[model samples]
Target: MAATGFGALDGIRVIDFTQMLAGPFCTQLLADQGAEVIKIEPVEGEDSRGAGPFRPEDELRAFGGYFASVNRNKRSIGLNLKDPAARDIALKLADSADVVVENYRAGVMDRLGLSYETLRERNPRLVYAAIRGFGDPRTGNSPYSEWPAFDVVAQAMGGLMQINGPDRFTPLKVGPGVGDLFPATLCAFGISSALLRVARTGKGQFVDVSMVDAVLALCERTVHQNSFQGEIPHPEGNRHPLLSPFGLFRAKDGFVTLAAHFDAWWVKLAGLIDRPDLATDTRTATAAARVANNAFVYEQLELYTMQRTKKELAAVLGGKIPFGPVNNVAEILEDPHFAMREMILKVDHPGVDRQVAIAGIPLKMTETPGRIASRAPMLGEHTDEILREIGVGIEQAESLRAERIIG
Candidate 1:
């Protein structure tokens, strides 16, 4: 593994009090960029550590794929926050840290005496980022701000479940946690912006991201269509709502997609498919005519496409028309494009002897490059080393271990 002490964020220290996907994913990005991200896990570890997809060969260690996927390039320090000593140590760690990220329900940090308001009093220039399921109440009297929520609930209430799928008859949530990931990305951005402001003003700020707000921002197009055009944007299946000839169609072996959106491309498509007559036909001549007769035009295209294999159709349609064959996971893994771009990276993990391949970083930068250096850590793997760095001595660290404050 390459030394994490030399990445782009080399000098930036992040005290992470977050767990599960969203918060961990955000910190992982920072870790990859060279931040010294110290993940302060509870003594038992994060909820994601137990949530599996575990390796059958190694069940004892914290090697769950879900946890590993979003938590590489970071060190873990176990701290039982319920313990007063551990809480004190956590504050000490946060005081010297450049940034602190948390995704607990709004008031959980306050309950733990680790809120931005409290911590910033001790570390004036610290950047604090928080993620939530929904916006905090503007005026509140209840102690319910500490309630927890998962990704699925965020999806259901965050407008994602309303806009996804074929139609109003059956609304489907997105395949991945779009709600969680969106807010996570935004939280990371907010943290970066806060860090910048702190650098200039010498004053830290609190950054909050709501999964519900993020999803609504993502669904702004739907909102605009309904309000401006009086068009409730129903899911048009695989087809795009505003573009013609922009959907999947049947091929002999499987499915092929088409996107001949421009009128000039439609002319070329007609020629390639040997349907020149339909190119100038009264019902299909102009763009509006073609869109009005889209059902008939699509049915005709499918008639020809269904007789040809995906490979055959794609070969013929290749740049003459914009098209692609439906590719599955196996196909994607074997694809030349993905391999050439280094979209997959092979890592030799401690638990697994053989190398395991996972998706690599998407961003490509010339100077400050990102690399997946280390596999996810075992629970409390760096507990002693990290505690010592936080000014705790070896003998005191041992006592903390004996007292179960550090595990």
Candidate 2:
């Protein structure tokens, strides 16, 4: 772990009043960029602490892979908001924060006396961000605002699933939790923008991100295609709806993909694959022409691609016309590109001897470069330290702990 923080958001204090994927993920982005994020968990721990890919040999079960991946570069404190004293301490923490983020249903914070309105009154320039299934009432009202939503619900409802999978009737959820993760990313961006605004105006505002709305916005292509051409887009599988030779093809060992859909690339690809005739054939001569005869185009490419292994095809086609073999996880780990980009990061795991890999920061700031500064905290790892930072004495912390108020 590094002693010096990433300088980008060095003094920006974030009170993470969130748990699970969406909220924690958004705050983690800020944390990675050097925000002082103090995560507020429960007395025992947050729910995701038990969401495991744990080592069978480790009896502690301190935290799981799911928790570790999204929670790096942050500090945690356990407090029971049901207790009035605990709620008071939380309010004290929020009073000093530049941002307060949560992903609870509309009224959860209010019920616990930790609403945005109450916090902003005490700290006028506090940026309060809420990520929800349907958004907070301060922004707009929705019938589904009260309904519970996870990644799957957002995917199915927000048009992402409709535009995926093998066919129209068999729409499928994307493998990753895009619904949650994308909204979390958006919320992070929103928080950054809000911070910039605070610098100018010295006024805080509510930043609301709806999971379904975020996914729908991500599925922008589907909306435009329907509007422009009256085409209700279907599941595209591994092919594009408007281009030929722009999708996956069979290889002897595994799958290979290419985007040789442009006329220049198509002609070049055909020549490279020893089918110069495809460049002259009227059916596949032009990009639009080949799209009209897509089946024939795929058939022709598959004829060549299927006979070769993915490595063989890559050797022939890589960088010549936008082509590569489909890489699995192990292949990704072995590839130098990932290491060069610093995309795969290894962080220490509690109760495990060896470090585990998680995805790293994607942004590349030349001056204030971000890095995973620390592993996810064990439950309330900084409870005493944070309490002292917030002006609570050691005796008070011990008393709170005895009363099951703080952990």
Q: Tell me the lDDT of candidate 2.
A: 0.92
Looking at model 1, which ten-residue stretch has the lowest summed lDDT?
A: 137-146
Error of 2 at 21 (Å): 0.7
Q: Tens digit of lDDT per residue, candidate 1, span 1-407?
A: 22565456778899999888899889988887888888899888888887877667764655677888888888888999988899999999998999999988877888898988889999999988888777454333234344566677777765667667776656787888887888888888888888888889999887877777788787888888888999866656776666678898989999999988678998899899899987788877777777777787788789889999988997899877788899987888988888888888876555666776777777676678777878777788899888877789999999988988998
Q: Between which residue pairs do clashes occur in model 1?
A: none
lDDT of candidate 2 over 1-407, digit per residue (tens): 12336758888999998889999999999988889899999998999999998877668889988999999988889999999999999999998999999999889999999998899999999999999998888989999999989999999999999889987689998999998999999999999999999999999999999999999999999889999999999997889998888899999989999998889998899889999999999999998899899889999999999999988998899989998889999999998989999999988887788878999888889999978889999988988989888799999999999999999
Q: Given candidate 2, what's the lDDT at residue 353? A: 82
Give TM per candidate. 0.92, 0.97
Q: Specify the highest-TM-score model's number.
A: 2
Candidate 2 weakest lDDT stretch, 10 residues: 1-10
In order of listing, the candidates' clash counts read 0, 0
CA lDDT, every model vs. true structure: 0.81, 0.92
Give the poorly placed runs of model 2, Cα more than 4 Å off: 1-4
